[model samples]
Target chain A: MTVPPGRRERKKAATRQKIAGTALRLFLERGYDAVGIREVAAEADVAVTTLFSHFASKEALVFEQDEDFEQRLTQAVTGRAPHEPLIPALRREIQALVRHCTADSAAPIWRMIDESPALRKYEESMRLRHAETLATAIAADPELSQTATASRTIARFVIDAYSLAREAADPEAAVDEIFRMIEAAWEVTCPSRRA
Target chain B: MTVPPGRRERKKAATRQKIAGTALRLFLERGYDAVGIREVAAEADVAVTTLFSHFASKEALVFEQDEDFEQRLTQAVTGRAPHEPLIPALRREIQALVRHCTADSAAPIWRMIDESPALRKYEESMRLRHAETLATAIAADPELSQTATASRTIARFVIDAYSLAREAADPEAAVDEIFRMIEAAWEVTCPSRRA
Candidate 1:
């Protein structure tokens, strides 16, 4: 059982959401490069220091769900049903993520990211970090019995599936195609588990 | 047959090499972020415009071999001996690249890159571009006859092998191990080619 957040925690969450929502609106309205942090803070009714407290940098504001995204990926490995196969779990998660990102609502945000070098660079490094975290989670699973290199490689391949699928003409089909490859790659690492 | 360059081209090539060497030496000594473009041009005894012509950005100075690297990856696909298998050819090229980047002489340059977020981001994007070129080469090959998605997925896996191997404790072994997985992944896309 989980304890619900206290009042203080709830207020902090509200503040962060407001800041992020305001920043995204400003960025989309005028252009990511045109907007300034001070302007975002002013418009959000938060101090510059408060904005910094919430997000590490302007790039961080644009990727407000960075931590959440990382956590979901890791959890998809660690929190799956007992005896659930790893590749399928990851495939489901990636499919959902591709759906979320490719939804019509997210098009403008991704367009902004593709157009701006700063955002693209930031997203690249962010994905690398997520891949590393996922690697650690995969390595820690005793049931998988994969070598360190295998674990890391599969993690990167899964992350690549997400990235590649997002850009494909048919994101869902791309995920399925890529996961079929990943499933084969994973089975090779554990010959005993081959069906 | 390849023809030798004329005098004008030879002179241009020499100037480009000199500028790259000078900039690298300075970056290694004084640090990549601390050195200015003007300082590098002055030290190389070329105008700022000439330096810019040779390298598009300061990050480009550190990665002078970027174009060469991209070309070599694509060539590994396009220029392989007739009837040579695809996975092993890519494995050999990636093995060579990992060796080049992991050499003692290349340690300091990679260290500098790891220390700077900007350089890490630049390298990430550069690798993406190389992956796309590789995918295109693979898709254009009549013998492979892979779906565009499979070609692209395998291209990313090959690039990931290079990157993950570079950071591994035993880069050569890492390359071999990762390629085993890639070989399996590739075979699944071309079931007819499976042994």
Candidate 2:
């Protein structure tokens, strides 16, 4: 995927980042609904059409982050240490967020999602899609899928745990705690997880 | 605080059931958006205002069965065996849905919900509300709440598991599998329950 690096590509990338940052700032300052798309465009120093070009819609400002969340989780799943299971890799990703986001202003992005109905709707549906993807992955696994029915339940339960953890006041500790709980539940269901 | 054995209560119950049953039949036969208030009333042999008295909106008709769902789950929590943990009881109540709904009709209902963004919105919000109720109940339990943040994790995981079971294709194994998952998840999170 060579980009044939050029000024246009660099500028286009910059515009997306700029618009996203501006939209996030505006949304955090004045709740999601109170802020208008026009204001966001103006604040980002872009025309309305430019803003729309960057983010199709205002909701996309929030939803874009959500869409990326599952991708990152999937990356962790695929790139796990050979000895580690999927949950351990997932725990690292969430706990990493607790450190990185809290130190930055990105924490409000999560709060915005928790507070906004539209955003929550987008987030929940996106997680369902992620769970579905994980189900496909689990289904491909010869051992797990044989016993677990396509891994839909396991994937959904894990996503639900993560969603609840995201709502926690402390995402890092919450991640560790949730992953541990899920492990226990898995053990009870499979009994051999304790081993 | 028992109801006096009288016509009013009986009539009210009959009216409520009539409206719900009629709405389900119509929605099942003609699709949710195809029918209207006037049509529902005519089909139920009731006036428009009478229909309104029973169900505030069409969405309520779709979710009317959940009143009993929430109530029964809450009662299961409150009257749970003192020694039995909340997660197992929650598991049983969730598994019980299999005996009733059987995932046979789940695809249509899910399709109806998925097709109409409004129903999906309604169902998500309703689930959030149920999580809140379960959280409050879990919070009140000195034993469970004190151990760790049992309330939120328990509620969310149980719900995630139930949703998984409901969406599963096999009625025979879904509930048993999901319940096993939830209980196992709870044990992992709760120190006392962990192996």
Candidate 3:
């Protein structure tokens, strides 16, 4: 049902991945602030312009998945099955996200982000934008739109829970705990309906 | 039942206020990062060493009320009356804090904070500390502590709502709106409980 990328698309994707991977390695090795963009381009065997074409900023390299993550969260709510409540829809979306971000291969990257203030601030901005994006989607529905405060509150709570979960020692346990908390939040805001 | 400061204590408080006021003015005029601490000290008619003694860093000067704000949130939870619920107690605390921060006299200071990334980051750090402090207080109680996720979720929800409220054109309305959201949260999390 899906069409794969053609040669040009595949080549661009490969270049982007290579640049990002090389930048991450260099950043992790020499520290984010210390590593220059020229160094990354040189190490990646690409021009500085090519690196800029791939990523807008150094922080963008570390957070390469940000846009995809935001899209998936918005789509999860907007694309929920009929009769499915918002909380469970979000839980499904968040579970997948947490799994992806917490995979075995990503541990070092997560640790790197934890140690860097620049990355943390960048991550925080992304987190706020995620909440805003979700909020807009939630507000599009007439039923949820009427309760603006509650809608934004719920959106923020879910995102914050997900971010907090990332810090847990056991990602699965953290995800489960957050899911339960979401259910509890749903119970208060929408008492007549169940998640 | 409260005691006022002695003459020496009062003079120290006055001096600290003068330095903070001068620093804020200079930061606002020349930008946060551009303004030097020595300039602030000179403007306030105090030695640079004296200014350093009062505030550990420039960021600290910009966020002078942060410690007081955190203490008040913790005390609100800890000092709730026997029958008072957590939500209203937090509401009362947040309302007072919001009023203090959003006063007409504090508009320029808030605007300065809004314009400066360093100030925003410092404020975000303070906000996280507030959540941690509130979570610890929430955990001290037997009922809510059982569910760690819910306790933290609620704490974060309260803090986030308050921060969002500050951006409102009419802060009073925003405060009221946030309080209602808090009540909805309490209803969901603590169903039969009154707090």
* Comparison by DockQ, 2 against 3, better one: 2
Q: Is candidate 2 or candidate 3 better by TM-score?
A: 3
Query: Per-residue lDDT for B41-135 in model 2, tens only?
Result: 89999998998888877787888878777777677788798777676687688778655665555657667776786687677667767877877
Predicted complex 1: DockQ: 0.77
The regions of model 1 sitting more than 4 angstroms off are A1-15, A45-50, B1-11, B47-50
Candidate 3, DockQ to 2 decimals?
Answer: 0.30
Which is better, 2 or 3, measured by lDDT?
3
True lDDT of residue A43, candidate 2: 89
Ranking the candidates on lDDT from highest down gives 1, 3, 2
Name the 10 consecutive residues with the lowest summed lDDT in model 2 chain A: A141-150
**Cα lDDT of model 1 by residue, A160-192, tens digit:** 999999999999999999999999898888846
**What's the best-to-worst order under DockQ?**
1, 2, 3
Mind giving the per-residue lDDT tens digits that candidate 2 earns over A127-166? 7778877666655643333355526766766676666666
* DockQ of all candidate complexes: 0.77, 0.46, 0.30
Alpha carbon lDDT of each predicted model:
0.92, 0.71, 0.79
- Which residue pairs show backbone clashes in model 2? A181-B189, A184-B184, A185-B184, A185-B185
How far is B117's C-alpha from truth in model 1 (Å)?
1.7
Error of 1 at B69 (Å): 1.1
